[model samples]
Target: MFKFWYANQQNRVRWANSFSAEYRLECGVRQGGLSSPALFNLYMNNLIDELSRTGIGCHIDGVCINNISYADDMVLLSPSVRALRKLIDVCESYAATHGLKYNATKSELMVFKAGSKTYNTIPPVMLCGRPLNRVTNFKYLGHWVSDDLKDNADIERERRSLAVRCGMLAHRFTRCTTQVKVTLFKAYCQSFYTCSLWVNFTQRAYSGLRTQYNNTFRVLMGMPRFCSASGMFADADVDSFSTIMRKRSASMLRRFRDSPNTILGTLAERWDSPILGRWIRLHAVK
Candidate 1:
């Protein structure tokens, strides 16, 4: 049945209102197909298993946590530079054997260390015959990840997004009715989706975010810039900034506790760890 569905798949391109001749797909699945990610996962399972057998990446209590994968986005984690290079070598070999290739230009290497000029001293990691860029921070899956592993960059990103949304709302929807404005505000503005994962950010950064969140509602409602936001959220029937973060983080903790995967569940067990403990203390359900 699978062969019948996948065999002799043909595709064509449409450009300038003209149709090109269909060509047989010699390899790879259809892009954006529902099963593409699953098929890709199946194809990459052998590489994952090989990496596991090597036992060269980060591990926690006898569990191999060398990699984090989501569809095609994969992040390799290792405690030391040597182990990381080995993991990259293994990935390169597997990609060659499987007819897959890594784009060295898009790839970046970041080392997590405190006050160390590691990038200057360490040799570059090569992929596809090109060296990967060494970066202090990079965006992954919509969140900014830094070598310091702090949440400040992501928070600043969210704050900037909020400011842009606020200006859009004020300019585009100034004459909108209160009900319409409220609806649009909730849809466009209250998007602190990654707040639950914020742990290592400073108080000032969070306060700035709160200021922006309040300003968004104020501008949408045509209220004074310095007006108190104490009653604004209640009047708008929307969640407050603190409430949003608290609720999301609580849900995250619950998921961690109830996750079927033992490694994920271990995150909840380590609630007292420096990272998780700060999150729990600041946002856990009272």
Candidate 2:
């Protein structure tokens, strides 16, 4: 396997001079290539498997989930601070053995329920003998995740971002047709609100988001702020904001249900009661 990987990697070259000086890559996968992510995942799988054998991950319904990874980003979870530290040690050791190094500056430690008063009790975590900074909230994959898992802060941030984008769009596309404006709104503005897969929208949160959506449509249609948005929505032939969010949530749940033996599937199974109950309620209402 090592020989094959090295052989395939030898073809990678970069020019050091305008025409003649070429250097061959002897190690590390190429960045931004389509195959790089898969290759990296294959290399990291061994380390993850080793960690799994140590049984130091979060356990739920007899299933152990130590980490969730997508491409190179990973989120590690443990039930206790000691176990989390051990996992970090294992990761550092594995990286050293594999000719890789962890960027301690980019790493952060967060303890759930470790509020301001009790946060000091949680011990420090070190990478390369340097302590990692602790944070009360962190952004992961475009979503703001807080210790309490509340969506208020994240929602407000997204709302402001969307508002700015809408203003820019309206300014630049003033001469665009109504249909074109609608298309752009759906493509650009809607994605910011819908991309957060883990958001559990409460009534208040949904209402706020709905208002933003209406204001966006009103701006696109050149309608007065006080006018009813329903007419513009009907002209655009787009579903209501709540309906779109509900469909997205339901689609995500269905995908989780259909996936078997994976991390998400295991989570869905463990939370079967609430997930299934929601599904039933949704269908009944339909």
Candidate 3:
């Protein structure tokens, strides 16, 4: 009977989950996921504990160049294959300590500095499903993510997120009267002012809320006067805006604006009073 709603969407959302016993294999540039750190840490911690239980001889946080060495990844130096074997025993024992097991399939062991006068063979094992013979780059955390990759990912992630936010505004954000959603919109607007270079992040956020509430509160509630510009907090660029006096912190003001709590946590901060002048002076000292 209802043509518009029925034609527009389905009543249920069918989700496909990954729980199949059969392996699924696809290869491309495997980008690091957002939750990779927490996941990798859990996996590594298990392996480390397992190796320790087997009476291993590896250092906990290995350091070669004093301060230059990073976390977790270790470099073991030995003269002979026998020494490397001993190191492997240590690794297995360590694994057993934490109720974990590390078979060869999931581990990659590589021998470096082989048959050299100055440097003996250095063997290192990669934790994340690396091939013993074929593995070229090391896995730091869950990614083969290097500093260069991180720099690219940082910018790329930010840009893609902006696009996603724009897409959300383009599609899903149709319904309203959600106090929680309204609060989120208000919070983002109050935190940072984004304008162009990426879906006009700050401006788009404001424009979005207004567009959704075009019927009732758009023109009225969404004003720079009543609604402070996020730039008032983000770019503060005090030199750029000389009109704002050293009255209150831009962040404090922003927080107050976002949160519905009218009664400030402190009695002095609750209301605008002469004591606020003294409070401001105290803040300046610190």
| Model 1 agreement with the true structure over 1-286: per-residue lDDT tens digits | 6567788577888899998999877777788889888888898888888888888887666778888777778888888778888988999999988788898888898888665544456777788889878888999999999888789999999999999988988999899899999999889877786888887779899999999899889888988888768787887788988788777777887888888986687667774666577666765546
lDDT order of candidates, best first? 1, 2, 3
Could you tell me how far off, in angstroms, the CA of residue 207 lies in candidate 1 after the best superposition? Answer: 1.7
lDDT per residue for candidate 2 within 1-286, as digits (tens), equals 8557656553434467445444556677777778787888898998888778778888877778898777678888998888988888888889999888888899888877743434555677788888988887898877788776557767877778878888988889989997898888888777655332534447686567679888987887688998866776777787766556567667767788798756777766664555455554555666
What TM-score does each of the candidates earn? 0.89, 0.83, 0.29
Residue 84, model 2: lDDT of: 87
Off by over 4 Å in 2: 1-27, 114-118, 193-206, 271-286
Show where candidate 3 strays beyond 4 Å.
Answer: 1-89, 96-100, 103-144, 147-150, 175-182, 186-286
Q: What is the lDDT of candidate 3?
A: 0.38
Best by TM-score: 1
